[model samples]
Target chain A: MQCFSCGFNAMPGSTSCGRCGANLSLAKAPIPVTPPRAGAVAKRILPGWWALNRRMAPLLLRIGIGEAALPALAVPLEVVVRPLIAMVQRPVSLLPGVPFIVAGHRAPGWLLLAVWIAVMLLALMLHGLPVIFLLLVGGAIALHAASALQATGLAYRSVGARLAGIVTCAVMLLGLFYLPLGWGTMRIVGGGWWVVPVRVPASFPPFAEGDIIWLDRSAKPNLGDVVVTFRPQTLRRVRALAGQEVAMIDGVLLVDDVPSPWQSALRPLAEGVRFTVPDGRCFVLLPESYPPGGTPPAPTPQPTGGWPYNRQPMWTVVVGEREIRDAGGNWLPSLGSIEGRIVGRSYPLSRFGRIE
Target chain B: MPEDEDPQPRRAAAAATAPAEKDAAHWLRLADEQRRAGSHESALRFYSRSLEVDRTAVTGWLGQVQMLVQLGEYPQADVWAKKALEIFPQHAEILSAGGQAKCRMGALPEALVMSDGALARPGESAYRWLVRGEIILAQRERGDDHCFDKALILDRDWLVPLEAATACLFHNAPAKALKRAQEAVERGPTSPRCWFVQGECQQRLGMDSAALKSFSRVLELSPQHLEARGRVTAGGGGGMWRRLGRLFGGR
Candidate 1:
């Protein structure tokens, strides 16, 4: 017999529609998949990944930030993962790039993935005052694993409804995946050291101009310790770590209104300028003075000429967050981006301020 | 007199799903009946006859294209769609039929344009959304689940999911096809057509036992379902495992 609800061929005595779940006995005509208009369209097709992402946008919006931050976990997570990656990488170099493939990209994706990995590795190796990279790259791989596990676990969860609920729950737990891993790196790795050599030509009162100096890579600077560092070729001082307000009042360097002790050569232009430093960043005396204007001045790589290095007063130095890219996708300087400097105008002057 | 004059459409709609009506548009009713009875060639002839009876009836033109596509005459369908477009250029159903024909003929970019044209037209129907979803799936992207869901919301018919599953099954995505088929089953658990489609999808996915259960359900729901009966008997006794062994060739 015909099912009245959906016009399906059903058992002669059926009470409801087997096709549309409509009441077959209602005397109501089955709403066979008739178009609101007498339209005829054909067979339906399945969705693609690109379309699925569109469907999952709400969940992805919240997940995107955490996913973007997932690479950060690599830094801290690497403390635990380092051994496996390090040894395996010696024989099978492809192992480090596995996370990118797992997350779904191949060649071009590897380029960004490698850079992220480098950022995490640098955070671990630099031991800078702002050290979050350990939690990014290394932890990224771990985060993926954790989120994967979380998804599988949630799929089996009685409370969860299909893939959507599982994915939502999985993203909710994205950040927590790196915490314990970070703890292990913090508790076990403790800290390490780097002995850097330097030519302090100008700070002669503490030491001679040509005197060589070594600084610990992980140590917070102290009195008599030189901190102007640019790797093996150059050594720099950490002028002021994150929060201290710094000013050069009338050619005299002052930290928190007190005359500073470890002074790099002071600049004349920085007569009364003062500002507090932001987190994840530090203030360092620029090697040169900058002219004041609405438009910013361009900065050169480094003065080929030696010290009596022009001691420019200030540039609010910022950690070069992952946005260091040229139009052609080249990596900018790995060192911190001094937003106040006019370094090739890589950033918007009004927004990130000019690199002087 | 007013009661007697109460609209013919309401009563017709009440029996609309029944394929044939005693007093309806002459050739259009015959075309619908032929299409319903699974004779695409006969449906195409009747649709052409309806168009001859009334050239302004866009429904006959759409039916002609639909039946041509069903008969695998994609080029003819495209030609009809173009001729129909010349007459009713803004008709969403004609545009959608053109898109479907173009997609079947392997002209993806043209299909995309036609599908987008259908979507741009004002007359919103589940057909437009379903066509758009099919076009998207033809692009080999996997996100049309939402599109199909939207179509279902527009018209809560079991045929929507069944059609969606059939599309996926034809496109070599049995896993996804099975999901769509399951959606159909969810909408109409007792439907032999739904069960049959689900069984086909499951067979494609190599889920033999599940496919068997679905086939059995089809038979139970509609004892006269010849295809379901054939599938059940074909897999009867020892041919079951042998059929199951040809997993990849299921599609």
Candidate 2:
């Protein structure tokens, strides 16, 4: 006889379920009566689920594979995505120690929970795109396999009644999430690595739209290397280093009168301009416009959507070197303003590696 | 989700669903429907919904645990089963469910103990017998036929034999599974699922032509059966079924 409680089968006249150990006699009480669901919500909404799992999933199982095609696809949504969706409807604090609390010192799960809260506050504040952006990033880093008990240090919110929509939540969460954010940014800064989601002008080479810049702050800027400068705050390729003669002769870049690669898509000078790049200063120029799908991408590790949330810097400079035209026409930025050189992993699809 | 929150976290009421519409029995029906329809995830959510409406509903709790196991979330299933037991201690079904999880996790001895414990409980049922049979089969042993036979005797449903056949097949006993599959076919000759089971068992036993015929019969019953269609088209079947396969799959 088949055990109704848990689908176990046993010998004829067996008193109890051999698999689940339920008494065989009363087994029928709990079995959900299998009614033909004609026009039922399940049948209407998920015909494929019904057809496949009822048919395909069992076949796959008997063939030594796994369960439902829909369920297999839905696993990620159930484990990772749904909790995040539930967090939004969270009339309560859904992410106590969900994302951040890490191993002993810190954890990625706890931080992600904090990120989610921060994003919601932004949503309440009506900062629409940013909220969507942050949520997408948060949703992508789901913690279905997260270790729970290690996050005991996350009970720091005993003070208030915790009520707010996306805006007030955003403001409050900014301070809350930014507590760890400030520390994390500082940590990365001290560790000689700087990561930032950067957007640049269409004329800028290498950096793609929505590209993240990972800089090796400790590395010295070299010729043909793309580096970030703080003085004018732009990503520029180093054409002429200290004491190197740079001349925009007949619209050609000449480093010490040798034909250098014309890296900029902008017109920095009209006449045959020549100047000695002063010591401790490098002549910088925004690299040539990188055409989308023109060159084969460099096989870099970090894909487009990576570990999100870093200190953002506004990309105000459309053409930084041209702005220096009035001030003696020298586009040299001091070495101290040069924060760091862009690593190979910076927004890989474009021409970051090509600049060298 | 227990992945992050307490073992039995307070589920927030869904914003889109009106409170008046949140009937536990209705949700339970929907959960069962979804499970039958094949989306364990949907069923899992429905069970959660039912529990949200009425946490005391043991069926909802069991459904949640069963769906998790179906989705291969054995660890989560085990955890949920333990939580269920805390509320309804000595629940035969819950014990069997837990045993199923332990069996899946490769803990045969623990599973056998849990199964035995379940039988010692008062709620005698065929499901617990099937659970026992499953645990026995999982142990790579051959003495599970009696356990399955007891389940078949208790439930007399064609699905029981098919389920037993599947359990036997999964446990590497194709010959035994084939017998069970034949019994299932005898009980429910028109069911595409039974024919499909027979076909699979035939394939496992290396009865290639007979397996093809069984798959062909499945196609004739359920014209939309994709796997059977593939088998039919791949020279798995001949005669009238092949012509039917050409008629359906020609385009």
Candidate 3:
């Protein structure tokens, strides 16, 4: 017999190999094998049809879409292959302006860039047709792809590869830095900042028409904080915090029997309006300055006569409690009545920071 | 006295009555039946047929607008509601539907006005209240849950209570959500969404056993419910907690 280890001829009935010193008897029963469990064996050997039926046929007992869709879980290999083949055959053309970018035609690039800027400006100005936003985004992607593809080509060309490679690296390095910057900015202002362009007729003297203001919902309002309320769509300043007794006496506002500096800002208050700010509530005041002919210049003309003239004051004080009441009338705000504090202003570039 | 009346005049009157009775009214009844049977497509078709027969039918316009809303076609619903408004200038139902469509289309201010107008009218239905609640909620206004309660009070046997339960949960009022969920379960026992709300409420209340039962029932009803299956896999099996943790934003 030949030795399994060295392939050397061995004498008959030899327990060990002669040349290689191998144990021939050990080779008789090699690698002791254990049979797998029935379920595992069945899973490994069953045909696709049989396996699918075995898994899903029992779902007939259930009410709705039961395990009948189990076959979908075992995705066909071709499902992945087909998409990959299609992608290779006709790759997405994100590089729409590659010719201009590669040829260094600065005009085309500048023109595309201008289009993007104009789209953004229009979005901010008109605030209509959000579809422009999608177009702007697509244009940006096309620009980026064109630049990146051109950089790749320049990196391979021997003539200007050194300069082109440096430019490409710089562009990629800047892009890497932008990821964290985008995340930080989104965290800071996402859904918390809103811009007001129109001179909200409610906030006139301090906030003029055409002045851009930023509303910061994250900032907690303090006593005397100018905030926006949307009920009657008016802007007001928080005159009193929760649990403070606020009263307007003779066209003057007082908190806890003490007049605040905001009293000086008031046009004039109506007398005998006593409001004790309840728990979880604050008193807000739109100084009589907002009416047709009040001080600080009313932004819009007020209607004369009837219910508006009878009960409504030029400067309105909304008593905040379980519900907001205007001059103790029946009008109440829906929940989430208060918008946010006017933390900063941006439109009037002359006075472009925090509001006093 | 009857013989004195000409037979031709009486026959002509009868003919006019039959045609008038068989017009838009007949098509509207069929649309209502289809809507009740959960055949929304057929119901929409019948509603259009009714409108074609008589463009002045307010109920036909309302039904079509409602179906469009259900299908998430907000723009079309808004157009149909506007048409309805032309016929019935101050109709509460049309205004409520228009408000809802406007809310979905991101016109919050306009939607608020429409909802206000609807609520200002007397004898408003539960649907109008529900739409108002949705508008308030979309605005992120405080106390939107009160509107949901108003809708429930208007009509308890509707999906409005289930939505109210969701709103309560969103506002962090779990006890109130449980009450609404209980009402929803009583009204719509066969609906998986109602059962799902009940399960969520029970889970929030720390009633683990009852929550588990509710989740299992959801799975038994619809085995393909991935959320229910996840809950079962996590709570029933010890080792699957890691997978559940990964799936439910543990990282």
The C-alpha lDDT values of all candidates are 0.53, 0.60, 0.58
Q: Is the docking of candidate 2 incorrect, acceptable, medium or high quality?
A: incorrect
**How does residue B151 of candidate 1 score in lDDT?**
81
Write the candidate numbers in order of decreasing TM-score.
Answer: 2, 1, 3
lDDT of 1 at B128: 76
How far in Å is the alpha carbon of A10 misplaced in model 2? 34
lDDT of 3 by residue, B59-98 (tens): 7778887766555455457767875665456578889998
Give one digit per residue, the lDDT tens place, for model 2 in A127-149: 22355556654543232212221
Query: Model 1, DockQ value?
Result: 0.02
Cα lDDT of model 2 by residue, B1-251, tens digit: 44766543243444445555668888988887676444678988888878666665779878887776666666457768876775556688888988876665554555677899889987567778888988767655566888988988888778778777866765557888999999989998988878987887876665768988998999888899888888767655444555465467420
Best by lDDT: 2
Using lDDT as the measure, what is the rank order of every candidate, best first? 2, 3, 1
User: What is the DockQ score of candidate 3, to 2 decimals?
Assistant: 0.01
Q: Per-residue lDDT tens digits of candidate 3, residues A157-216?
A: 343443444454344424542355457666665566534332455345566545556666
Query: How many clashes in each structure?
Result: 46, 57, 9
Instruction: Judging by TM-score, tell me the better candidate of 2 and 3.
Output: 2
